[model samples]
Target: MLVTTPHQDHSATDLPRTGPATEPAAELALLRGDFEVHLTVGAEAADALAAWAEEHGVKFVHILLARGSAASQPMLTLRASGSYTEVLAETRRTARRLAADGFTVLRAKVESVPWAEGVPASDADAARFGAARYFEHHVKLLVPEGAATDGLAELAVRHAAHLSRNARRVRPDGVREQFVTQRCRLVGSETAAARLDALLADLTAAGHQVASAEREFVALDSDETLDAGWIDEVAAVAKVAAVSTAA
Candidate 1:
């Protein structure tokens, strides 16, 4: 089951106070309690590392590598799967193992961006793809490069929720299954309503076949479900709620 606990912001305590001039050879840090591990690797090596991590029961959380016109060896990021708390525990175990495997832990900054908009689609395939909900949480992470937007994976992780959906239908291999869904909290009566309104506006503008909408939710085109990239676009409009106006 997905672990549910308040994500403690221990980045200051969890991360190093300073960094070197250049990025470290390899490092891992927990962002908002979720383990975000970064390491440099070549393009081919990156693919291999992903497979290896998965084979060892490590779920891919998010990844960010160097960007350029030409493809070359790049850094590999390993993340723990599940809620912030769940991932945190797994990360601790995985971090030690990764260190033994020649990886070092570095200070990373994590920021939890509030998600104010989310739209569910009506298509059955979208449901299967788990495009039913959107989630947001407080973020915390270490920025080695000082807040430069480097890669899509980094941006995606920093500003989005870990959407969970069912994999392709398959016969059970005598293993029990648990499906998890991620959700975001709306701060107040008016703010929640405003956010939902913005969500519906974006979906309709993006040519999504909107099915319905409400004060805090909406239904959109799910048949040709847009990936997380599209959802990111929708969420981009959601601004952080003002502290004084929060419920």
Candidate 2:
């Protein structure tokens, strides 16, 4: 369940004169919303963390390799998701377990804002929202630094054609074409998960090194409900894709 700190009573004169009232409005309600908990773990612990999430059926937004950190150890950002309460609980549990195992875990809370109230009141709000939804499951097929780009153009053409059969650009009328020219493509959650095998096979066969992929969900609308199943599918695919890249 979502919990909020109780607001203290204040006189009207004590409220700000230049802005909205300080008092919590009755119309302002808290809803059980989705959120992600971020934690940094060393490279030695990355595989373990990923395995734990898979074993426990936890969903993850992304896992990023932290660069230029002061620590000698390679660091990674392990992001886990759930409702506010669940994320807090899971983060604490995972932190405790990993710490006991001698892994350094630094945790941070990434809270979700109320969609409607958070957006700026402007004419571009609709465009902003549309872009958000379309790129909700955006994944990047990264090429390793210093890797050969010799065949990249031809490979991208072939890959784009393959993706066209399964993906559609967020804005079909937009100037940029997916797969063909743009490396980033918008795909359905299920489609992305289902295409992992083919994607891996194609990229590897083309002498392309897929170093890593990032995944995240951007809400289409303020009130959009997250699909736990879709999140799980993404999490699973991400894990497999990461392993494939390492191999």
Candidate 3:
């Protein structure tokens, strides 16, 4: 016989970040691209969910009774890390398996955090560095309005040799599956923010009608963990650039 309990209403003030006591070590070690799997189950099936996780080698990072619009429901959030492809595949398989086991699977969502080598001094620093690295290393260029694309392309070509000289290839874990190709994709734009600044400056100097610049972020790769905080310091300047562009 299957046993189930009615959904209860949890007071808004009673909800904790991770429910019960917090686990500092596990929370701190979480990296970008780590999977956040949310599973909703019947109120009385918490034990069954725990058993299923144990049998499947999945670790439950947090379990909480979340208040829904109408009622409170038991929710499980788990953390899993691996290559993008691997994590996605495993999440799908787990959801399918759970549904087949006579449990009501409400929803499963995956959220990715940017990877950092070590914990930031604070959350503010993390956001600063995260934005910087995103713009500098991940982004290729920011071409402002009416900027000479031909001139920029020519500049990139001319600086290709010099940029290649300073380029550094990152191959973490001795695996070629993920690597960063850091090359001189542009001249004058040595840093992430500098690239945008230079592009806008050049256009203004040349008397071009500059309204704003176009932006492009780097493509996603399997090696996000490599050099996770490489551009934190440089990104400080980028933070300013982002604001300036928006203004």
Model 3: weakest 10-residue lDDT segment is 159-168
lDDT for each residue of candidate 1 in 149-205, tens digit (9 for 90 to 100): 334233333232222212222334433121111123323233434445544454345
- What are the TM-scores, per candidate, against the unseen true structure? 0.30, 0.30, 0.30
Candidate 3 residue-wise lDDT, 187-209, digit = tens = 11224345555544544565444
Q: State how far residue 198 of model 2 sits from its true place (Å).
A: 31
Q: How many backbone clashes does candidate 1 have?
A: 15
CA-only RMSD, every prediction: 16.2, 16.3, 19.1
Error of 2 at 190 (Å): 28
Tens-digit per-residue lDDT, 1-247, candidate 2: 2111234223333211232332322322221345434444544565676665565455432332111232222222234334433444444555555555566653333333323223222324324333323222222444443443446444433432211111222334333222211111244334433444445566678665454433333331221121111122344346556877999
Off by over 4 Å in 2: 1-32, 59-67, 70-86, 100-102, 109-247
Query: Which residue pairs clash in candidate 2?
Result: none
lDDT: the better of candidates 1 and 3: 3
